[model samples]
Target: MDALDIVMNKDKAVPYYQPIISADKQEIEGYRVSGKVKGEGEKWIDLHPFFADNSIPDDYRQEIDDHIKQVAVSKYLHENRSELLFFSLNPNLVVPENIEQFIDRLSVFKSQGLPFEKMVIELKEHQFEGDVSNLKHFVQYIQSLQVKVALDDVGTSSTQLDEIALLQPDIIKVDLHAIGNSPFPSVLTEVLHSLSSLSRKIGASLLFQNIQEFTHLNYAWRHGARYYQGSYLSKESLTFLDKKSFTQALNKDFHRFLSFEKKKIKSQIALTDTLTKRLKNYLNNNKDFSDIDQVTKEIASVLSDYSFRVYICNEEGIQQSGNALKDEKGVWQYRVEERYRNWSWRPYFLENIVRLQYEQKGMLSDLYTDIHREERIRTYSYPLNDQLYVFADIPYSYLYEKDFLL
Candidate 1:
C-alpha cells in the first residue's frame, strides 16, 4: 500500500497491539501499539514502511499516528485494561512547540482513566535529528508526568551509549532481530551483556524484543531482560489478549532455560576444580619458583588438554613469566617478549585477581573474544601464591568440544 493511500484514508488506519511479557511474572505486562491499515479483503497492511519512509510528510504520518492512538486508547479504556500501553514516538517530530500538545493528549487519556504512569513512550534515539539536549528535555518533561520513557532499538541501528545516558530513559529496549543467525554470536552476546550491565548501572529495565525463537527467548532471559516482546510469545493483533495468556508456557520455557544455565554453571565449576587440582599437583612437584619460564612451560604441558596458552602474573597483574603457547604441531613454545606486560588495564583484571586471592581457588572467566586470536576463549586464573597467579587461556576449539562451555 502507498503512503499516500494510508494518509488519505485515515479511517482505515488502526492499531495493532503486540504484548510485552514480563520475566518475573511470566505474564503480559503491556502492549506496544503499531499502526496498520485495513487492506484488501480481511488483511491489514503494516504502516511501518510508511512511517519509516522519511519522504512522507510529517503531518501525514502524524495524522495516522493520532488515529491509531485514539482508537487504541479508546479500546483500552472501554475494556478497562490495567496493563501498560506503549506508544512509539518519533524523536524527529518531538519538537518544543508540539511537546505540550502531546502531553495534553496524554493528559486527556489520563483523565479518561488511563493513568500517565501506565503509559510508556518508546523513542528511537538513533533516528532523532534534533539536538540531543532538546530530546533529553522532551523525555524529562514527559517523565515528569509519571510517564515512563524507553530508549528503543538499543544495540541495533546506530544507537550510542552517550545518547542513552543523556536521555536516562526508564527502560532500554534491545531488539534481538539484529543479532539473528550471526556467525559471531559470542561477540553479540558480549555486547548485549555489556548493555545489560549499563542498564543496571543507569537503573533502567532491559526489554528484549523481536524474540522469534526459543534461543532468542533464552538469550533475553540470560541477559537479564525484565520484559520480552516478539512473535515467539505473541504476535501483534487487533484486540487485547488475556494478561496471563503466556504465563504457563513461559513458566515451562523458563524452567528449561534455568536447567540449561545450571548445567553450564556446573560445567564451569567442574573445569575450575579440575584445573585447581592439576595446578596443586604441579606446584607440589615443582618447589623451585626460581625458573619462572620453566615452571610456565611445565604447567602448560600439564594443562595441554584444556589450555592452548599458560603464563604467570603477579599480584598487580604484571606478567611474571613468558607466555607458553601451543603451535599448530601441538608443540609448546615460550614467547619471552610477553613477559613484564602489564595487564592491569584490562577489564576485570584486578577484580578477578582479588577474587582469586580471597577464594584461594581457580576461577573460570566468562567467555570473551581474544584480541590476538579473534576467537572466543576463557581464562582460568589460579592463585599460585600470595604474590603470584597462574593464568591459562583455554582455546575456542577446546570450549567448542564441550557442549556446555560454549
Candidate 2:
C-alpha cells in the first residue's frame, strides 16, 4: 500500500492545538491547528513531513488536509465559538483547478454559524507555485467569503515579498529561521523592522513563530508584533487550557518584560543626555577652529569610548572633512580622501540638519545600520556653526551594553 493509503487506512492523523496570544499577552487570540500520526511504539510523525513528501498523491493530500480542518472545526472550534481558528493548508494541494471546491467546503462551515471571518486560512509560503494571477483570484474569492488569509513561514526573500503583495494576506508568520538565537541579533532585528514596515503598509498584522525564549519575545514586542506562537507560550496538545489561568500567566510575563523595559529606557535617556552635554561643550570651546584635523582630534578625545567615526558636513549635506575612524589598534586614523559624499538622501540627515541650523542644538538619531560599516550605529549631529555640522557615529555595542536594544 502507498504511504498515504496506509496512514488513511490506519486513521492515525490527530489534531493538536497551539495557542497564539495577543501583543499585550492578556488574551488568547487564536489556536493554530497541526496534525501528527501515531507510530507503532508511541513515536509520533509530524504531518508537515508527510505532506511535504513528493510521493504522496495530490488527491490523498487534499483529503488529509480537508479531514484535519473538518475534524478541528467539528470538534474543538464548534465548542469554543469565541476565539479564532488558524487552519493551514499546503498550497500545492489547493490549486486554482480545485480551489472552488475548497471554497464550497468553507462556506458549509459558515452556514453552520461559524463564519469565515473567524477563520484564518494560512497558506504555506514555499508551496506558492502555479499561475500567479489565478492564485490572486482565488485569494480574492475566499476573502469575499469573509475569510481572512495568512502567509505562513514567510522568509526575507524578494520572491516571498512579491507573493505577499500579490496575495495581500491579513497576517504574515515570520519563520523561526529568520529569528534564530544569536548574541548580537542585529540582522534579525533589521529583518523584523523591514517586515514590520511592509506589514504596516499592507494593513496586515505580524505573527512571530518559534518564540522559544524570553529574548525572542522581547524582540517581537519591541517590533510591534501583535500575534505570537511557539513552545514558549505552550506546546501543541489535544486539549486547550482554561482561559483564566492561561491569561494570568501570560500577564505575569508581560509585566516582567515591561518592568525591565522601563528601567532600560531611563538609562537610554541618561546616556543620550550625557553625550549631548559633552558635545555642546566641545563645540563651544572649538568655535574658532579652522583645521578639520584639530577638530576631529578634540571631538575624538572627548567621546573616545562612545564613538568610532567623526566627520563634518555643511547645511547642503556635503561632507567637508575626511572621516576620523577608531582603528583596531585602539588609535584614531584619518581617511583624507573619503570626503564629498552626499548625505541629503538619508532619512533624517536633512531634517536633523535643518533643526540644528535653526535651534543651534545637537541631535541624536535612533539606532540604524551604517551602510559603510554594515553595523548598527547611531549618528550624533551638532551644529558647529551656521554653515557646518559635526557628525559622530557611535557603534551599537555601546547602546547594547546599556540594555537599550533588548
Candidate 3:
C-alpha cells in the first residue's frame, strides 16, 4: 500500500495532538485531537500540493473528515473522559456534505461519556474549498451540540474573517509561523489587530500558537490573548489518556512572567526608529510643508490604513484652518491651510487633536476628528514646524461610507 492506503490504514494519521494552555491558569487545560496528512513535518504545509499531484479526488475529504469524528475524538474520549480536552480537526470544506454526519457523531459523543464541552473542532485554514454553505451549517450544528469551535490558523488568511464573524467561534487559534520570528512584521501586527477586533465583536477567545521564545508570548499577552500554546511554554501532551505526563503538564509552569514595561521600552524605541526613518524620508523629499496641498493629498493615500484629514490650529484649540479629509471624489482644491482659514469653521478644532500636537512637536497626533464634520470622520494631524507652514493634513477618514468627514 502506498501513502493513500497507509493514510487510511494508519490510526495515527487520522489523529494528532495540539497542546492547549490557559493564559490565566498557565497550565495544560487539555489537548485537542486533530487530523493530519501523513508526512514529514514540512509536508504538512504542502499537503494540498500533494493531493493535487496524486490526483486524489475531492471525495477524499469525506473519508478524511469522517475518520476524524470516528477515530480521533471518539477513541480519545472512550479511554480518558476524566480529563479535560481540546480537539482541533481539519475543517474539510470539501466534505461539507458530510456535515450532518460530523455533527451527529459529535452529538453522539456528547450523549455518551465524552465531555463535549472540552471538544474543540478546529476548521483547518484554507485547505478545503468546497461549499461554504455546508461549512456554515456544520459549524452551527456543532455549536448546537455544545461542542465549541475554534478557527485554526486565524492569521494565515483574511479569507476566514467573515466566516469567523458569522460563525462566532469559541476560540481563534493563531498560527505558529506568524509571531515566531524576530522583527515581527507590520503586516502581521495589522492582521492581529483586525483579528482581535473581530474576536471581541463575537465574544470569542484568542489562542496564539508557535511562540518560540518569551518575546512572542509577551506580544500576544499584551494584545489580551488569554489562551496560549507554544515552545517558549513548557510542552505537554494535551491528551487525557497520558495521565502521568498530562497530570504533570496540568500544573502551572511559574517561570513565564511578563514585564510589560521592558517590552514597551524595547518595542517603543524600535517603533520610533521605524517611524523616524519613514518620517525622515518624507522630510527628506519635501524639505518643508511648502507643497502642503500635495502633502495633504498624499496623506490620505500614504496613511490609507488610517483615515487622514489636514487641519491648521493655533496654540489654543482655536482652529486656524481645517481640511478633514481627502474625499473619494478626489477633488483638487485649496490648501490644508485653507480648511481652517475661515474662522467660522472654528468648530473644526476639537479638544482631542489639541493635546496630541501641542507641546510635543513632529509626532503623530492621536486619531480624532473635526467636530464640524458632524464627527462623522476620524482625523489626525502633524505639526508643520514652521509657523508659516500653517497647513497640514487634519485627518482622513478611511472608509468613505462610515465617516462623512470626507
Q: Pick the candidate with the highest TM-score.
A: 1
The number of residue pairs in model 1 that clash at the backbone is 0
lDDT of 3 by residue, 62-91 (tens): 455456556655666567645445654556
lDDT of 1 by residue, 1-406 (tens): 7878888888988899999999999889999999988898968888888888889998888888888998999999999898999999887776656887788788888887889999999989888887888988998888888999998989876887777877899999998887775343675677788889889988999999999988888888888999999999989998998999999999999999889989999999999999889989988878888889998999998899999999999999899999999999988999999999999999999899888889898899998889999988999999888998999999999998997987
| Every candidate's lDDT | 0.89, 0.77, 0.56
Could you tell me every candidate's TM-score relative to the true structure?
0.96, 0.89, 0.58
TM-score of 3: 0.58
lDDT order, best first, reads 1, 2, 3
Q: Could you tell me which residue pairs clash in candidate 2?
A: none
| Model with the higher lDDT, candidate 1 or 2 | 1
Question: What's the CA error at residue 334 for candidate 3, in Å?
Answer: 16
